[model samples]
Target chain A: MSETPASSVPRRVRDASEAEILDRLLPRYAAARGAEVGPGDDAAVMIQLGDRYVVTTDMMIHGPDFRWAWHTPFELGWKAAVTNLADVYAMGARPTGLVIALAATADTELTALEELADGLTAACARLAPGCAVVGGDLSVSDTFTIAITAFGDLEDRAPVLRSGARVGDVIALAGDAGRAAHGLDLLFAEGVDAAGVPNADATAALRAREPELVAAQLTPNPPIPAGIDAALAGATSMMDVSDGLALDASRIARASSVALDLDTAAFAAEPNLERALRGGEDHALLATFPATSTLPEPFRAIGVVRAGAGVLRDGAPLTGKLGWDPYTAWDGQLG
Target chain B: MSETPASSVPRRVRDASEAEILDRLLPRYAAARGAEVGPGDDAAVMIQLGDRYVVTTDMMIHGPDFRWAWHTPFELGWKAAVTNLADVYAMGARPTGLVIALAATADTELTALEELADGLTAACARLAPGCAVVGGDLSVSDTFTIAITAFGDLEDRAPVLRSGARVGDVIALAGDAGRAAHGLDLLFAEGVDAAGVPNADATAALRAREPELVAAQLTPNPPIPAGIDAALAGATSMMDVSDGLALDASRIARASSVALDLDTAAFAAEPNLERALRGGEDHALLATFPATSTLPEPFRAIGVVRAGAGVLRDGAPLTGKLGWDPYTAWDGQLG
Candidate 1:
């Protein structure tokens, strides 16, 4: 995945003991701000802020979840962290700690794993200051898997939930709508072969041509701070727009028993309107606020909440597929 | 691994959508006791008991960490939950919540996953009362993996660390030491063919003959409650004896800058003294208490701390392999 030639990778995971690999990887992570006992213990201890805390987990696997040839280990780590952090932020909480469980093949390059640790550290420092990896586990497996569980401090604020949306509220989204999905389309169309095989040379060329789109797909920097802002701004309801705008909005609508009526004109700046509606993995924050509340920074109004069910585009029922489904969408293809 | 007939499992995971599978599985988990916002939200919010919490993570992969041919889905889930819970218990905290990330092949049976959820719930209810699965993610992968992150409430008590052991302290152990490892050996010797293929009939026969050993290996019930008892009784140091007595004792010795002088005479009651000293995965609690302190129920004195470095057996340095290492020990054989 990395451009660092395979020849330069000095050792594989199998060549070293688990302790040796951990000695190299663990130092790259910064200690959590609230940590009392960090990485060396059987469990990490952290000081809590309020009487409540938020927790979420997600997993990224090789083959079905990703194509190893199309992503650097650093990007994989960053994306994994971003996705989980987005869930915690959706609850109107500030990210504080992360614990990773990684399973990889014996032949995996040790340097790649180190780079992954670096990316995790960098993302925590940049997106959520004071948050860091608190603990982790390593194991050997045929299919590479990275599972991260992120914790957040509520800061004494009540968590915002998808079921809190009220009728006649303003619908807003923070961060790009379809950029990551559009990047996926570009990668498959321009960088992959007819048989769905990834060509590294073609991918590099595409990266050069569309750095923003490619970066969006690879290392997404979700609007983490906007979650706390929306909560403080009196958000009625909130969620992470993970499985496409239409699908995720529908979830909110179903949960709140309301309808989200969207205006495509608000998305006129996007390169593809359809992708904005149907594409997935953008990791944006979708929130609804009272009509009297002022919209927070980075959030732009795209629609309004009505007394109905499901999502509507320009006042019509959304047609075609809603979003990605791992079970039905994965076609046994891998890079 | 279950005795249920294969034909009884009527549906595969691929036959249903991810939402459909979630709809069936999510309800099986009980809400955490402190949950303000449980599953169905982007993240779960739990009210903290004190100003601090302990967190730990562990992963079980299909091949190196577990054998599909040797364990039922229920056992796998129980083992996964127990393993993580033991880590929290070792820190002298009460487990409050768990978030699981499960990845399995599309061809996996839907019933198997449901049984896994049931196992997780049963373990939480029985071992760590009030603790439950608060959130989880499901994905498709070629190799089945279960990654669980457990959170524990400190109850405003200080966490017990491995580095607190002092010279002249009493080294104590609660629960069986070598039974799980012995079960693994029995399975490999009697229930598997020379080519490393599992024979279900042989496995069933062996399970019936040695139920306790097999149960120890499959669904271990670690001394979870004793962790709090040890802490309340003024334990100097504690950890889960997961990687053999000699090896884990050596870790405490190195961390505390003292030697653990174990008496094999104390292990004479065990069926296999050698396995008790060198085997792994029993999930026993190992703690050190002051010489003047009374030992807690279920905890028995096994040795004493001395002014030296590393583990000593009857005044001699321990010899032979310490314990299991996934990287160096796996022989590329799967049943």
Candidate 2:
């Protein structure tokens, strides 16, 4: 959850027509490569590359996923787009285009919605350079909701699946670890109540001191090119660590019928090592490569793939809380 | 603007964990072609044909788009899938796969969600022979929301865009235009109160008398094959009449820089001409072809594309409210 306050603009969605909202937000999505027909059509037409395409969808709801008090509409949009892009990259594909489904209360400020659109396009331009927000649907609901679909082109490389990890492979990671998880701590440390209400005074003070950590949680800039790079380097199995290390690593382990043994000593030099191991939304790629292969830039070996099951920390069985599980993690109706 | 009450089922979403829900719903999706990684992975991998792909997304919210009392979970899921498939066909593409993003309050019944999943797979099987729900995300929200992405293969045929219609082309339509609109009226006349609440007593009476009309509104089965047929028979321009005939026709008119004049006389033999012209969710193909072209099955001449602006009803300017525009059309935050 976040504490990003609602924008104080006067004209809300209910005040304008749907056509007006579309007119205002549509311009934010500029044309990108391979787009034969762009937004404003019944559907978008884009050129697919090679013989395959990679696709994924993700959602960030207001209460369970974020709080307006902690994120600007722009940041929320950016984070939503970037995190979803991380998934495409996780599959060893180059992020291509997107279609967004945005729902909010009728009283939501138009400026807020525009800021959100700006954030989406801004992330596409910065993180996935060749991608664009090609299509979207807008509607009114009781709370803010965003469902984004991201597509990717694998070039000529075959997709790397989580089930392909072979025993004797070295497990590596690309991008920051545990940053978003710690970022969430900083958010809650601002004196957030169990009900998720943010104390304005604490939030403002934290904003002054822990801006980077807060930004990390609000607008994660995961390494988008690493997945394709890993695939090019012959990655056998890979996935984005949105669900933290041990839990996600176990997923790969079970899928590939291999166990992942991580060395805690590998993180002795890092601060918040626990967060790195337990934080979800790290949005980094966890991949397995051939044992003797040289790892790519910004990627380092963190574990080894072996014939077994589940995940191990320093060769010991991993247990306890490791990440967010929207269902069990939060009790009852969050919003 | 609906009057249906909430479901009375004892089990709500908050009662189960996400894993449990996934366990119950995943089995309904089964499998499909081109999906190499499928669901349960970080992202799904699928093969793309030809050089380009057609993509579109649609959203359905609880109150504005549907009501629990008015339909079943299966129908809701099926409607969402079928309507989106209509969009792919509108672009003259055969749908190959889909990814759905569904959100509902934690208190929502798990059974409802499962029924929805069943509906999605059922629609894919019936309307799109080889299509599958390849990927999806589940989240908690204040209201039920479903956002679906449907991708299609053009089979190397150039996409027939709305901008391709030319002056002197004849406008033709496949599938029923106003079936859904009249269906809505049937729902309302079943003694829906001002709060949009359905009177259960009246609902049962109307259901027994007008099952087909109610089904049209709740589960529109558009002629999906008509889109490909129109494209194969040399359609110049095309679109699905989702937001009523007049409004959508005007959209093509604006895109193609041509005026469309519909001959009401063409509907003299029809029973629901007004509903056909003014109802949204008709989920039918509206296209333009060369005047001398031989049209295929289910398509009939309705109007002509000519030099001018806007849509005409029997040579007269279209007036009155024509279709849905959620924001301005309804008041307050629904659902």
Candidate 3:
């Protein structure tokens, strides 16, 4: 946690040399488990477990991706790592190493960067043990940005692809679904001032009102272990539920050329079924298995694959808004 | 190459959906050689050739890293790939895959993105055959940013680290040195208008006047293949010469806990020895080999390792302005 600064302000990035910044920050990020050569080299070398590996990349920008007033730097770093790690886990692989490129304005405080590094290491320690930042780059930019690439080891198991679903396969879900979306809606409606600017006091009040929802939106804890469990339990197909359950399920349906029929009664216990169907950024694991196979722990049956296309709810066409698309949805508005 | 517009501007990124943009751009980036699942899945699965792998990352932002008037989209993409590939090659490894995260404004033209993709694949084809873009992410930002993470196959060879150099080793150079710095000087002195804005006509005229220098600055072709050769020929220590020769050589000396003595006569044929000694951004290969071993064809001996600390020119301590540090060097100006 950072101390509340006085009027003079704390030391900024521009005040320190690049080498000084690295000397202060690199030690905070834990080294990767199997890295033959870690940071301070031209490249980091990692020991491989099998003959195949999985890699995924994701980016989070200051404007469209997040608001500084609503989330701390630690949360941003944690979410950035979690997003890419979820992608690797979707393939039933254990994450091994990560390479991050962080771009920030010179006026930004060094404490913010230090907290961000702390958050990255904390997430890896809690979610996927043995995975850590192995190498990274830092640069000055007009906009603050965090770009991460995660690598994983398969250990000889075949990758679980979204196109492998078969007719009569049972669809299963792991982790929270609609909570993050509900939290975002709450933040927009009540956590901002009259001018749509995020207010610290207002955000704190909103978090107090809905702790679980706010936490889910700020720091999601996806079922990372369940991905490998589902794979080992004979999953036919798998994906990360990033762009809402319906949209991501539709992707699996289209990729496999099959229809997914969800039972509305199955999710009746969810606080908000609509948000669960149409919200985004939960990063939960969505997987399909043979009808005869038992569902993996933490994974519950939600739908079944049929001989058709598109997504269905209770044997009818599912419609309305699906998910977030950064290209078309962003309206040039900052936090 | 993009055609010069007559009057009306081309379609901007905001006009098309995310899916539409991906459909137009993904095909231009060729598939990675060993990718079992490329681009479409949550993560890409790459077949490993050995029990070890190399990874590195680098970032290029529009304001601090490049100017649109001086660099075309193709050149930006090519240089981005080349920079990271050089780091992998510095470890004596063969690059195999890259995952890029690109963030640009909504008003950016689609042709620019297309050309960037073309340049990425073209660089792979020319510099490191069989390596290609395998996965990536896109986002909207106020500043254009390209963050790339490159992966390489070690294939049973030991990685050449900068800390392995010993006394009596012969230091060698394998690529251009100071030419890019001279090209940068030309751009700043003659390729800009009165207001310090980069002028297209002036840049073209400068390129026409000095083809190789301008090319080295904008589109450098580093000695990627020579890295593997040096390793095969028993390189003791290696590094990618991103900073000036003197500054980067100091890094090797410090890491190895020894001194390096450069012979000024070795580079007597250079057009500008000062730039060669103090300019950066060449992405050349600098390595050390045993005194008894024969130097590789592309590698020419330039100096020798001595039992001391720091770098020296003709047995004297080397001193002057060395290289660049983005955190302190950028002045918040754009072309």
Candidate 4:
């Protein structure tokens, strides 16, 4: 891989080396405010808010987390950024800038890295408008991996925490759910094809045609501002949807010491109720509101919090566990 | 390893399974942030700053970046947090939160993980006062690795960038340099002890005394607030010390379209000029200021930026032949 000269090849998506791709991607955010520094330095510097700031990070691995055959480099980059940004947004903070660390094989195609950068730039353009891809480390690893750390500002509004959920609060969702899971189901379930057709194509087409689901899988649109809106609207408890709603709601229930009774009927009209119940990677905003509070647009009531523990559907406990936990007996495959 | 009941053991550092150790560690953060969401949840919520946020991430691998015998889990954790937080702080922003991704062997001891968590907590307490350990993922891998993503708040200040350096700026250094390289030299060279004796017993005190060197190696103290101070002090160009000073300064010079000339006399006056020149992991701040700007306390003038390209010491170009760059044709073994 070292034998190939970086300049000899045309600048294709998968032909650029990590450094080459970074050079192309860093300049896109030249106009962003507070981006006193951009990518390529040891680290990027931004202005601080009051005395406090919000920070978070996440990593994406090759085999366990994603596969190159199913997703493009751009999609992978977008997903990586979205995953980290969602955490900040979940905190009810708006995301501003980013620093990315990449580990790739020495022989990996440079075009692939360029595609990844393109995906990253697309996500940053939307989620973190003026955010810069500041500093990062590059190394030749056995496998390809991308790690992202995101910085956010908490605009002085109180952070919406999970423990704030209370009995009698209405549970709501600000984005779609189960789409990514269904997309994965179509991708791995066999008999599904990329081209739109009938028969099993219904599931495959649903996975591909549904921009929400495909987008959910490839590049999650984290509702960072929506979270802030929810916080300002006095949201009691808030979070992002990376796991199934039941599993995530159970987390809130465990933290708030309250039972979460999800209304399956509320989502009965939507396809794939089981996926919605057991799906992951939606990157949606799930919050609990007091009975008297009014919800903003794009948010729909999905359930209610009760004075108990665990998650239930129509007052009955939804069994057949639906969530990903590292301790559980995982088959090393996505559900 | 799976046979051990992780729940029955004391939370203190104990040799147990990874599952058991994580079971203990995850609950603490959840309990500590009783008001915030627990770690078990998909994503955590933090407060938002303005309309946007800053983000960064890094990964530490076992073979390439770190070795098990050389560092305990606590030290590893501390290093991970420091590296990630340094990026945010280098952005002239304050860190707000963190999410850690850990990959290790199933046979890993629970106590090791506890120590790692303790290290992370210690660093967080010092560097990021109010930030939360928001969320993360853990998985079994062939080798041990830790990846950390850190988030920060750029309250409202302008971000400090690398492109702002200009000609005729005085180069300054805040914090020590080259200590880690010296420590590495001692550790790998003749098995000489790098860390000074703990002042516990005479038998353990036979090795060389290099407190500054060992501390630089084991735990790098990133100049967090100082980066911001440089920005406020009208620093024209700035960066953190990761690679050797020569290579990093060259980067600043190239970016700013200027040449940087080092005062060899001043460098030679330092206790360990070799370490200061070629050492890595100092985590110190290197900034360029107007020749007329007031020098901040504790900052040392080391070089000056002039009209041209590359870095020079005593009017001679430094090709980093003596500096650190992994790809350089240096033997793996240190001198």
Candidate 5:
């Protein structure tokens, strides 16, 4: 018989199960506060606050949004945690804890799960110190999927909303972009071999090594701490990089009754212009600062907020419309 | 052609779409707290605790646990929320918020999703007033699955745990038992269409009609308020019903160094004695009271805690197991 369609092939490796992933991931979160009972219990027990709590969740589906050929379980796990944690950080909060729900096929191997958990552990260790996984449920399904819910503590800071961006503010980006997009391009491009490569292998060593682009796609270092820093620095508005810059900038522009104009020349000077502009999954922090505020390090000046609507590049309209929107048709492939 | 095997049939409804289901469900949760940016937003937002928070999550998969024909979208949503909420409440906390992650075939209809959301909202309204549907992610998948994470506030009460039960205590249950098991029996025998016809019709006619068994199966009512009450009443140990009474009771016994002597005669008075002993999903509150403490109203005194090693039924050794265990060869069904 002819080979099955690539789309119909199960992308997940069978030997690494979700439980094995958790076993590798849970220990790193031992430092979280009020974690009387952590992972492995029926549920995790944490010290509860009398005040309100911030909560959010997200899911990563294979095939439709991600592919096993491009990403390892480790990278997928890390990216999933970052996506959820960044939302909490964008609200001007410190993540306290998280709960994960995973669904995989019965044949998934334990090692693959371990690698995914390692990615989750690495990400959580960076974003939420002392936070431990409390409880989760696992089941066998036709494809692999992960659902995560992150809880955060506002710590008395006012929440930062997309609508808070004001006119005449300076729009700045903190953290790198385009690396992930480049990485995705390299992974999906024909005649490339990612499986044979070693971890220490430099991006330049590979024929398609695009360091800046690949970094952005593979391990999105969400400026979570920087979001808090911006909030403390009196940022008026803030959000994370999920959709492309052009699309997300438009959202801020629409919310604040202002036109967001990006300096394209500045982006061009960067390593990869296309990746910096349209590249998504950067998890970078974009905030609006008033004219009076002094910009901090790593916070690059990208654009300005003016009295208008929609995003502009170098005073000209951006054509392709780069960014993430659920209703629209995405590339339907993961980096 | 001959009729297709049940396994070959699509799990989701062919006519209703996913988007349609979301449209209907979003409005029902319009009143939930922290729904500032509900379903349509990139990520939902809510107020965070000025301090700490408790979080937990669970996942339900088709085939391994549930069949589509046996449960409606509403029941699945409601039960998913209930299971997660019970974990939070078991820690002697009151639920404050929820996040859902869903995966279904693209062919699934919107009406089905709306029903699921309806079930979720209905359960939340009764269990956690003003709790928000903070955020979630959705995707099309080969199988139908759902994951839910719930958060809660302790409100100054100390969390009651399983480790606190001691000798010379009274074992009590607040809420009915075996109803879920009996409902499962009916469901397996007649399938969802014919199962609980009386209760289903009564629910349509009068909302107050107590479909104890059927309701137990569809949507378990975890005693959130009662958990707080138990903590306030100086309960030594407490937990929610998930595994059968015998197994869960044995857990308490092992943890508390007490032998539990359950009165079989008391359970025999109930219509479904076997179901009560082995059935799960009761979501009922089981707690141990000190000898000097007065039992609360509506709570049935089912057994006594004595210094010993394991669980007993009417002072006799249990010849057969009384609760469900994951390691065992279960028939692959939900309680």
Candidate 6:
């Protein structure tokens, strides 16, 4: 929280050498069950249960993907890991292990880094049991950055790709949405700073007022279980709503060469429909299934696939920007 | 050369959108043979050739791992790829695929990124025939950094680890050494700058003065083939001379719990023993074999595994540091 320091106790990284940092941190990250040989070796040998592995990597840097004022080091590590794990789950694979690269300036505190390791390991245990942080690299850089590459095993289930959706299919959504965008709004309105946020108990006060919203921005909980459930229920196409529902739905449409038409009336009763439909980083699973198939729980039908491209609302083509595009969107500028 | 600029024509990344950058550069990097499904998806699906897979990652930040004045973007990409590949090879596995995470400031030219992608593809084509750049994430950062995760297939062969060495074994090394360290010296002596080197083209003029040394630093050609050779020839223990020979050798000694007594006279005939002995980033494979076995080409016996621990020069304990220890070595301070 902005009211608290990145670490409960301050300890600069320069106070200890790289060796001491590794020694203090490596033990904090638990080993994965799938790793035949774990960290400390030249390379990690992770056992395979299938013929192919699903791999994805995501990077979080101080200036672009996130701002230090909005999140703690532990939150940074947790959020970064979850983003990649969501991608792996979106492919319908069971998460296996992750390799992390942390680069920070000499001024960074060792306690902050250790907290980051704790968050990473803790997140892995909660979201993807049996999966662990297998290996990592530490380096000094002018800006703080975290790069995580997560892998998963398919386990006989065919990967559900973005290109597999078909016309005449039922489009469905799982997991919550829009809270992160609202959380970002709260952060913007508060104008937090490095000097620290007033004397308010940031996390506790935010929790009492907008706990879910703030948490959505700080700690995104990806629908890890729902992805596999959708795959098992014969979902033809799937992708996580990392970049917002409208944009991600459009992605599925473009990839599958079909059209997705959403009904605004279906969500009119809900508050903040625009944010629900267009807010990014919800980490929800958007999927399509055969119209006749019984849909899975938490996955409610919101649209129908049609013989066209792009996304439509109220039977009309949506105009203007629908969601975040790092290059084109204003939110993409400096995170 | 710095005079030519990072791009033949200026094209700042900030001038274009993220989509435009990907459109301009993704095609430059080739796909690998192992990918069942490649980039542009929720996750990459790569087929495994064996029961287990070799995975390792390394990061290079501009200020620490390299200097902008000394190496071009292409060279940075190449050197970074080789460094990661060396870890895979050290595990006695054939390189398969790589995932890269690149972060740079918005002011960087798109052409520079393209050159980096080209270098990644070129390095793959050269050192790893079947390997390819699978997927990646691009972000904005104040300092330029590249995080590469490379994986490999070991087939049915047993992995040669750093803890397998035993007493009465012949210690050997394959690949060139010390040139990179001296190359660092050349860069330091030349004092290259942001405005570009005066009169002399950095790469060309430096090559004319010390081609091997300069090349060693800018574009190190790691001994990719010798790793498998050592494994096939029954290497008891193995690792690459990445940090430095003395430092890495001591690592094997510590891991295997055996002393390595080196004969400096064996390398005395070689020019510049300091570079060969203490210089790092050589990417050369070092291994220990049974004393009775014949050594392979490019691999020469230079020491003996003994009852004690740590590295020794001749009969007595060697004083002063021989190679880099990231934690204890001064080189680890900023970098």
TM-score of chain A of each: 0.96, 0.94, 0.95, 0.85, 0.81, 0.90
Candidate 1 runs further than 4 Å off? A1-10, B1-10
What overall lDDT goes with each candidate model?
0.89, 0.84, 0.89, 0.68, 0.69, 0.82
Our tally of clashes for model 2 stands at 16
- TM-score for each predicted model, relative to the true structure: 0.97, 0.95, 0.96, 0.79, 0.83, 0.93
True contacts kept of each: 0.95, 0.88, 0.96, 0.28, 0.55, 0.79
DockQ of each: 0.88, 0.78, 0.87, 0.25, 0.36, 0.68
Model 5 chain B scores worst on lDDT over the 10 consecutive residues at: B198-207
Say what the interface RMSD of candidate 1 is: 0.7
Cα lDDT of model 3 by residue, B1-335, tens digit: 25555655446676777777788889998878878889988999999998899999999898788888888999999999999999999999999999999997777898899999998999999999999999999888889999999999988899999999999999999998898888888988888888888888889898899988888988889877789998999999999988788888899999999998988888898988888887899999999999998988789999999999989898898987677777777778753
* TM-score of candidate 2 on Cα atoms, chains taken together: 0.95
Error of 5 at A329 (Å): 4.2
What's the ranking of the predictions by lDDT, best on top? 1, 3, 2, 6, 5, 4
Total backbone collisions for each predicted model: 0, 16, 0, 53, 33, 2
lDDT pick, better of 1 and 4: 1
Candidate 5, residue A228: Cα displacement in angstroms equals 0.8
Docking class of 4: acceptable
lDDT, candidate 5, A172-239, per-residue tens: 98876666666665655531345532223333344354554555676777667777788788788877
- Using DockQ as the yardstick, the better of models 3 and 6 is 3
- The CAPRI category of model 6 is medium
Cα DockQ of the candidate 2 complex: 0.78
Regions of candidate 2 where Cα sits further than 4 Å from its true position: A1-10, A191-196, A199-201, A331-335, B1-11, B191-195, B199-201, B331-335
Q: Rank the candidates by DockQ, best first.
A: 1, 3, 2, 6, 5, 4
Q: What lDDT tens digits, residue by residue, belong to model 1 across residues B30-87?
A: 8788788788899999899889999999999987878877888999999999999999
Q: In candidate 4 chain B, where is summed lDDT lowest over 10 consecutive residues?
A: B197-206
* Tens digit per residue, CA lDDT, model 5, B1-335: 13343554233433233344455566776455645555543455554442334567878777655666556788898888888777777767777778888877655666677788888888888887777566677766667778888776666666677877887788888776787777666655444333333234333333233355556777777565687677778888877877788778887787777888888777876787767877777878778888788777545688888877788888876658667643243332342
